[model samples]
Target: MSADAQTAGSRRSSETGFAARTGGGYSGPMPDITIVYEHPAWFLPLFTGLEARGISFDAVHADGLVFDPADTRPPAPVVFNRIAMSSFLRAPEHPIFFAQALMAQWQAVGARVVNGADVLAIDANKARQLALIAGLGLAIPATRVVHRAADLVAAAATLRFPVVVKANIGGSGAGIVRYDSADELAAAVADGNAPDSIDRVLMVQEYVPVRSGAITRIETLGGKYLYAIDVDGGGGFDLCPADVCLTAPGKAAVSVVQAHPAPELIAAAERIAVAAGMDVGGVEVMIDDRDGTPRFYDVNALSNFVADPVTVIGFDPHDRLIDWLADRIVESKA
Candidate 1:
């Protein structure tokens, strides 16, 4: 193991003493709530939320996290997972696999993991996202999954024109390309110009044009609706709700007005969260221009509420999120 991994292992081992002292119960002081995550900027609001409540917590950077399978219990009782699926886009070295393993480890030991391992697994796979969407009886654009570049042509034949080829493991719109014609897709495949797949898997999906040139994203906390916002659909794909992402050139800024998704759409988003085993996250849906039906497209296990939500959505979701966390902490102790 690397030095960082060794240090993390050592730290967990030492914390066994605290576990022993508490007799595996939440009797004494509350255990620290460890935030396992990547991307410092995305977590600033979350950090602020915890600090505002004077909650005892620690940030464990997932980039260097290490967990021993032999260790039967997590050092911390409450773990909030904030590992982004898009980490690979920012850094050559990503800890997605390591983070997944660590989440499983935490769950095995009965740690109160918010947005636990199952959600992480679903969030990392777009095919799984589609399956969950379809399972929830929600509308989804027609899509086909392919494992080889040679299969792209055949897959595109099954979808409508102006299809998008997306990497199954895509995050923040990293590996997505729109092809207006089969000839265009074939040309890209022939020239090795196709978007490289992170997991050697791709999805050719029909492009669903938005009805209002905007896509609605609903944020949920502890499996309930917190707020919703609409982002300009004309904006290119890297639609991370963080203020930094919105500043990119050609990226449409988030609307300052609160967006109330249809009541049915809100219910569907909540069901999607429950189906994916996510406690906190966002669900993205757009009204199809052709049918006027809301089609659920993306399920974000790690939700970064749009920047300055109070101004846009009439309330600060992070404060509400922290309230949920505080309740979980108290419940864990009880």
Candidate 2:
């Protein structure tokens, strides 16, 4: 998509999914809520819960590229921010800057962001996330977030064959690649990582061997652990449902879930969440079959439980998530 086309799509999507109202417009003493999201599929349950509570809310169409709420004033209450702007699903730089800008716009008019932009910034950066987890004394694999090819080679030498390289951003496993050999890693890096084809630095880590063929994704809201979603990344590079993925497992792939994680893993995840400053987020940890210990991996700010039924752990994660978010939103107000 051309830059103009991309920007236009983002704006249309942001606007279509949300409804916005200004001062003297919304009625009732309830919080005047504005949900900023681009995908309608994600908003349904969230809006449903808000409406169930009889909360007065609006939708504001804003994309990461051209998200400027110049005409609207920030209404009282909070902004449920769920905005993304990267055209390339696999490789999204901190396009969340747009979400930050929107929150800043709301703050100018006297309102609070649900999780706040600062929380998003800190959690979104993979390198930063690792540091936070490490600071919390959690066990993490010997990982490397490198920009240049030479550095990647160095990191590779430190690991066994088959290193995992994931795009620094995006959800549903957009630009996640696994190279079983050093040669494979070199070729993937040369091919230009994602749609942007920008020689962006890729995160290379020692692929934790897993016998179960699934990764454990645990969601936490306002520092409270909710539920765990087992994401079967189909064991390939393209796991993001938004894209065409052949790498993920077909229906034949055996996937299952348990209500609880190993006690140690859960405790570790809780610590990671707190240290990372994630008000509402998800932490992905891979259980190493070799050591039978969980390794902290990805930390997502706008963590998704929405696209559940079809992916990972088969359950209506969105409903549980909506309930959790609504509770937190109300709790914060209280």
Candidate 3:
């Protein structure tokens, strides 16, 4: 066997039928957690958390990921899928469809994958997200889905004034533009100034004025409530939770404050997470100025916890995340 394969086999053998060592002196098998992801910066906290716990994990780069259909059992017993829908912004040439196929393959083989294929599907398509929102009886923005640019103007007419055209498959708030009037949207389309959707699908959604100038993001882990944070929305579209991305030139630095969502909101968020088949994720809700009712807008299966959790949210969420993952690993073994 090759040297690397031999080492892996040795490590796996050591870990079999035994509890892995901990407390910085771990000599057991390497971490069984395999993180499949695209962005590097967003995952630094998770990597740090794993290292701090003396756990070693293998990272699969989504840009060049591959899978063999015939190989039913993957290398890791537990895989944490961290692939972002916004990955197209970083690597436009990457095959996102292939990533989806691979996730489905992983599920077929019964791999213990967090944020599995179902969540990835919902995360990639906004139309599907809207359907899920409506199906769950949650309040969603008045929205219309369109395929061709010619339909953009017509679609805008159906929604209220001051509507936003968003990409059907959007991430980091890409391909979203606000129009004050239908005439403005038509002019943009005529001048070819309208943003092109990444997947050629667009959603014209009514712009509900924020009542508090902020939105609440409730995060869940292992299908249970973990914590919630409020993000100032004056920063515009891109509201990446990672601090590094929050420093864009034109984008205001978003302030994240811990929040306690109402019982109904908490229940609603949990229901959405379950409906989306998400194991770890965040749900965004904004109260409409017109009605004072909370509107569920975004559901994310991949969560990058706000930076400096202790200072921002009063505790480090990654610590709890690590514990959850460890328990999951142990359960998989059983």
Candidate 4:
């Protein structure tokens, strides 16, 4: 069969199956919401949940999306941003910057964008997020930032040995490397070992020892805390809840347990989300084993909520997420 024919058949089957999830009674106008996303598989459950609730949405791939600034109408009344930070790991021609412009245009014409461009700008740049978090009087890891690979060695000198050199635009721990000593970092830099991020910026940061051998990832919805997970870092940098990143080559499988962090941590996570303009996202923090201080590190706008929500978090977060999106859709139309 022709590929197009096969795709059409598969789409029909998918629609039929999605209808079953919500009991097959939705016959409303399509495009109540537009999901701006890149990854193909991560949002399948989200789509199913939206279908279950009869909330019609259009999914647009960020990689090849095109729009004219003069266009006043959005594909839907509400636009949900699912464009990821780790997109660069999948392709060099990733749409990190393209998404920024696209969402800004969507907002300009008054689309009720969930996790809009301003939040995405913070999400895209690690250096900017650290500064933003610090501006709130929160504790961040001791680190140095540099734009040129040549400056990496000098930056590492300020921090103790066993530091990670991270890319400013890294996603899912893409451009992170550890150097145990000054000599090792210098040799890497001399031999051109400095990591190449989408943008040329790099961060040389002191690796904080993880307390209890795990880091905390707290998820938020509508700028409020929804759930938290303790992902065992296990001496690796990538702590994405997705199996794809956790089981990547050279990375061992990590344990994920539902966590009940202190009220202060939950409050802090909510505060960061509100300040960062994150409508639906997650914040990651590592408790410094040496000082017992919780150091906020990563602000992720793209939250593909834990692998199996029911088994992991006792309830499916996607249900609540779709409910919120449905409310936003109603508000947007009004």
Model 3, position 165, has a per-residue lDDT of 86
Worst 10 residues of 3 by lDDT: 17-26
Task: Provide the lDDT at 41 for model 3.
Answer: 65
Model 4 stretches astray by more than 4 angstroms = 1-30, 243-251
Q: Between which residue pairs do clashes occur in model 4?
A: none
Per-residue lDDT for 1-334 in model 2, tens only?
1123222212223323434431123333445566666544545666666667666666544433343355354545677767542333423444365566656766666566776676666644667777788877777777887766546766777887677775565455555667789887766557754221133546777878864877777777767777775656557433232212222345233243543677777777777777766667678788788887678877777654534454544565556656655665565577
The C-alpha local distance difference test score for the whole of candidate 3 amounts to 0.77
> All models: lDDT?
0.77, 0.59, 0.77, 0.80
Q: For model 4, how does the per-residue alpha-carbon lDDT over 307-332 read when each residue is reduced to its tens digit?
A: 77789889989889988988888887
Between candidates 2 and 4, which one is better according to lDDT?
4
Q: In candidate 3, which residue pairs clash?
A: none
Model 2 stretches astray by more than 4 angstroms: 1-31, 64-73, 84-87, 90-95, 187-199, 237-258, 306-334
Candidate 3: where are CA atoms >4 Å away? 1-31, 248-250
TM-score list, all predictions: 0.89, 0.74, 0.88, 0.90
Give the CA lDDT, 0 to 100, for residue 86 in model 3: 80
Error of 1 at 194 (Å): 0.7
Q: Between candidates 2 and 3, name the one with more favorable TM-score.
A: 3
Candidate 3: tens digits of C-alpha lDDT, residues 1-334: 0122222222221212222211111123545777766665677777767867877676555543445666566546688888888878777785456667777777677668888777888888888888998899999999988888788898877688898888887787789999999999999889988877677888889998987788899999877899998888574887776666676567666767888999899999999988898889999999999999899999988788887788888888888989999888888778
For residues 1-334, what per-residue lDDT tens digits would candidate 1 score against the true structure?
Answer: 1223333221322322211121111223435686776775677777767767788776565544556677775657688888888888877778776678778888788778998888888999889999989987888989998899889999889778999999888787789999999999999999999987667888899998888778888988777898888877454676677776767576654553468877898899999988888899999998999989888989998888887777787778888888888888887767
Worst 10 residues of 4 by lDDT: 1-10
Best by lDDT: 4
